[model samples]
Target: MTRQLRRPPETQDLSRESPTVSVVLLSYNRPDYLRQAVASIRAQSYRSIELIVVDNPSPSSAEIAETVAAQGNVRLIRSSVNSGYAGGMNRGIESAAGRYIYLTEDDIVLDKDCIRHLVEYAKERQSGGLVSPVMYNKTEGTIRCAGGEFALGAVYRRRTHGEGERDTGQFARPFNVTYIDGATMFARADLFRRLGGFREEYFMYVEAVEFCARALKAEQTLTVIPRARVYHFEPPADANASANF
Candidate 1:
């Protein structure tokens, strides 16, 4: 009888060495928008990410959560009452269990490297409490937010850059910034908990700005990483996107 080749021992278990990152998104009644957002997230280059989607008591949101959950790496949370942006995000953030937590919108489409780039930038900076990227408007192909600065009077925290190509170089470099739109924000979980998350009183607008301001007051560094850009899918062309916000 021919000698049988020795077989290698079978491995019993396998585990990933990298830490997990949690992406928390808040959704209302926009099921279609949630689908697009989930699709983009499922295509991320990073494999160790947990997606947490919180529905703010929308009548049709259960279906949205089901559809998103089908894609894997997703957790759905539904509220009994319609909590606005701040309240919903608070719930999502509390459920996230990753070293880094990404606060984002259900209507945005992310680039493949968006999360990876943000994590890398945060690691390199070593002191960034919050990091956000340049956001582009899907409808007009224009720049939405790229490092805002506050000025005196009406120009305070104004977005000075022009639309489209005119705002190209504004985000070419990374530095400490005044405010980052909550539409896409990556923050260290530890730091986030320490800060107690967003001030829920704002309800909607200005909450993000207030968070950054508080972070600054506490001497926590907030940086804008230019390499990671995301598409902010605002209102369609048929509607007045400006008034919608």
Candidate 2:
């Protein structure tokens, strides 16, 4: 089951804008972080954006709806079941009307110019299929993920670049990468729709990796624009979590 909160009348004018960027923010059981993330997106230097909030059956569903309602120009989609990250993102993407889609998680805050930088870079590099910003740990101020690639092996493994390093301008230059972190991804709307969004069978983990791999196989270039940055408030790993999938 799914419910959609209507957007305010004032937000209707957003469709008139050319080349609008739709931001699909996936939230699950974290209302406070959702508020902060929404605030950061609203504060972006790029103003032509439409925000879509997908609540993945959060326990705080009412609070999530309230937060989204308080922020005008936001469309809220509430799911009856927790479909994990991939499904939630797909829901938002299906309703997106922008030429560009910016997929993000609830606990990350974007830099004011983050979207602007991404849009500019994407336009400059027409062949780039996916572009993502450099992510830093919000509390630790250390690199979370600059960009990443898979290790050549029979099993799936990833090698993240500059995972725990300080901002020393080493990964500052924009370059091609094997995959972009799922926390914050920017790409053309058509590309995502054409690829049928993410494979929901995996539920949460490795969806981004598989999506990127498919995109690469389709001859799309994945890249990281280091100038654009986002701060991620990543939670501690669950002790019970396993890689059995």
Candidate 3:
């Protein structure tokens, strides 16, 4: 109708310039945070991505749908029960239709070039199945992590921590980290399938570690590219505590 035709073009960048990347952003009850997460993806420099927001049983899919209705190429999938991060994200991965699958959470705000740079870095590395960007917490004004390497046996440090430490490009160079945090990482769709996705046993914590271990077991490389970045927000109270998210 003429009225519908009079509507102006939306400011949201829903253009699917490249269909190679599929972002699987898992969400729970945090609708506000989820809104920001989806907006970040919509603002990405890389335009060839399809965003699949796998809602962990959002009570009102209609409300969530209305939130993202204007964002092109965005799909919302909901689970019947509360599936934790592992299970929820696994469902997202299974339904992804891109060559590169990106995993992220509702609290993370990705830099515009995060996906572009990550994909480019992975392409250059060729062998790496997983790639992560440097994570920063704006509220704390500190580096959450650069990337992590395994410690003695099963335990491993999460790279950088401490108020005294600085992230002034000291660990800026990309390196072969032992593993990448799944909160905001890119994985090859085929490789993700080959690894059988995240082990549902993990539920929430250790999902990334378990996935990386399986990838390594099957001879897949994991790397980090400082060029790519994402802003990860954490509560002031839970800033230092490793909460089982």
Using TM-score as the measure, which candidate wins? Answer: 2
Per-candidate TM vs. native?
A: 0.83, 0.88, 0.82
Q: Which stretches of candidate 1 lie over 4 Å from their true place?
A: 1-17, 151-167, 236-245
Tens digits of lDDT, candidate 3, 1-245? 00111111223233334437889998765667678889999999987887998876655456666776766678888877766888888788777777788999878889999999987776666644678888888677577877676653473344432223457777667787777888877877777776677767676667777667666777777777888888877663233222333
lDDT per residue, candidate 2, 31-139, as tens digits? 8888999999999988999899988874578999999999999999998777788788888887887778899988789999999999888877674599999999989
Better of 1 and 2 by lDDT: 2
Alpha-carbon RMSD to native, per candidate: 11.7, 4.9, 9.1
lDDT of 2: 0.81
Candidate 2 lDDT score at position 169? 90
Cα lDDT, model 1, residue 107: 71
For model 2, give the RMSD to the true fold. 4.9
Q: State the C-alpha lDDT per candidate.
A: 0.72, 0.81, 0.72
